[model samples]
Target: MSLHADALTTLRDWEAPDDEQEALRRRYLTHLERHPDGMLRAGRPDHVTASTLVLDAAGTSVLLTLHAKSGRWFQVGGHTEPEDATLAGAALREALEETGIARADLALDPVPLLLDAHHVPFCGPGENVHHLDVMFVAHAAASAAPSISEESLDLAWWPVDGLPDAELAPFVARALARRRHAGQAGSASGAAGSSSDGGGSSRAAADQPSR
Candidate 1:
């Protein structure tokens, strides 16, 4: 099977309640479900499949990474390592390590959304392909700053609307739409219940104090 077929077929059967709508992206989901303790990447390659989308306060700035190998500006994410026990856990670790941020203040949650697969010109002039991407909702401190790490050519946040027209052409825009939907859902849910963060419903329930 082709790479795309290999990815889509696996995604079609991914069994996770949280990913009902995103089950189609299961091909990109970590191959760790069979092994509860950690991910098994026996056949996985260096291509990144899933990621965490971390946006700033105004919901305008998006934190991006300049990958060590690809040098492409992408989200904080990578292939599932044998150590990753869960998708969300891997997303969080990737964000912290790649973006160089402390994990304490983040209220980031997971929202499994399938990123339409497509190949875009990468780096200088060699690698050109898009690994299937499973994007998740992530958060970073409004005050926390980004420092470019060795993995990136440069680290900077750009106005969500002002991303380079060329680079933001397809996949990036699709990823952004998911974040917008999640934020809107959070707002609507909050008004109906209570204001809180962690996974939304959990935060709302926690807001109710026992009296």
Candidate 2:
């Protein structure tokens, strides 16, 4: 199967010239060169999905998960199912389900798009194509509680500026940047009435032993 021109056009409209875009194309091409129909398998015109890098009360932090298989910290996202009017909904659904956050509370109407292309381990049965995923920024409420699910092994919020630089997904990092730019900025939990997991909350609870 050939790459969809419409999807390619969308990619062009997604973002301005950057090294990341070029790298994404190369990654997609490399994967397609091996197993075709990878994108088609996902029922996507092209292999893309909207994604979210949700932040918490602390303006300095953002949520990230260690993907079960890859063990890489990344934003929440998945494929664009037919029922989804736009890829963003698909991302929202995936983020909520996979992260066990009841609601993603996506903040933006027209989120900035990031052309993320990368290779992961096998998706499911008969899946082997690399993807040119068009990731977008989505945000969640600071009070949202993120539960670790099977899709993820570890989940946590890290300071945006202090985010680990080693082996971090570029898309996850860029999404954080866009989310903050969109006025979805998070503040470190410190004020009154903060959620349980926020930097605020009760200091007494913070002294509890590991469960």
Candidate 1, 68-106: lDDT as tens digits:
676567777765664555555666777777777777645
TM-scores of the candidates are 0.61, 0.61
Clashes of 1: 4
TM-score of 2: 0.61
Model 2 poorest ten-residue lDDT run: 202-211
